[model samples]
Target: MELLDLLLHPVRLRIVNAMFGGRIRTTTDLCRRLPDVPKTTVYRHVGLLADAGILEVADERRVHGAVERHYRLSRERARIDAEAAASMTLDDHRHGFAAAMAALLAEFNGYLDREGADPTADMVSYRQFPIWLDAQEQAEAVAALTPLLRGLAEKKPRPGRRQLLLSTILFPMGEVEEGE
Candidate 1:
């Protein structure tokens, strides 16, 4: 399946999100992380991700006669290539965007639901900025941000370090209405 098609499913998207931060997780770990999702559903989606090469087995061990596999995200295979992204139609983009937004909402809610949740202490930031930029400026902005984002992704999981989800959406704004 195409990367877009594979990831657009809400459960699949969440599964992928859970695999980030260079953490190796087993199927049991995923079940704990996504308590709302059924255990069978999580197993099925993890199998699909593994079959698609997006999730690879990092290790395995036998526990009480059952072998449990530890999986990690293959970052290269988890993303849509430039060619595939370029081929996406408006409708395709719409569906992909909607899926992404839904996943983000679910993750945010999960965070808020946790005990001792404190947005201020945790440094959660969710604000939109309206900026006017020409085509050249827009291109420059993306060029500048791309490397920064990649650098953050390159960091591996470590003790005392937390995994934070950062989602960004950049689009041209339509005509503005009168305001103060």
Candidate 2:
């Protein structure tokens, strides 16, 4: 499968997210964390990702006459490159976005289902900020935001650190008037 198709899949997306922050985990570990996903499905997708070079075996150990492999995301290979992304059609973009939203909803619902769930304490947020910007201004805005987001994504997981999902959407709201 194409890298975008593989990365955007619901189950595979969850698997990749589970391994974010340079985490190295085995299939068994992923199954435990993603209790909702079936073992067979996780194993299948992990194998696909490994074959695609998006995931690489970090280590292996003999277990029950089989090799249990630990995998981590190959950072460079895990993303849809610019050329590939540009090739995606509008329908593809819609499908990818929908899949991502569904995953986010699932994560949020899972959090709410847990005991002692506390959104405030966890700093959970879902808000919209409307901005009116011309093409040039919008480009500048994204340029400024990219580094901050990239820096956060590159941080290593540490003690007292919690995994947080960050999603952003930017689009034209309505037709711009002749002059702002």
* TM-score of each candidate structure, all chains considered together: 0.94, 0.93
Quantify how close model 2 is to the true structure by its C-alpha RMSD in Å: 1.4
Tens-place lDDT per residue, model 2, 23-51, is 99999998887777789988998999999
lDDT of 1 by residue, 43-70 (tens): 9999999999999999999999999999
TM-score of 2: 0.93
Model 1's alpha-carbon lDDT is 0.91
Worst 10 residues of 2 by lDDT: 102-111
Report lDDT per candidate: 0.91, 0.88
lDDT of 2 at 136: 96
TM-score of 1: 0.94
Q: After superposition, how far is residue 122 of candidate 1 from its true place, in Å?
A: 0.8
lDDT at 11, model 2: 80
What residue runs in model 1 are displaced by over 4 Å at the alpha carbon?
175-180
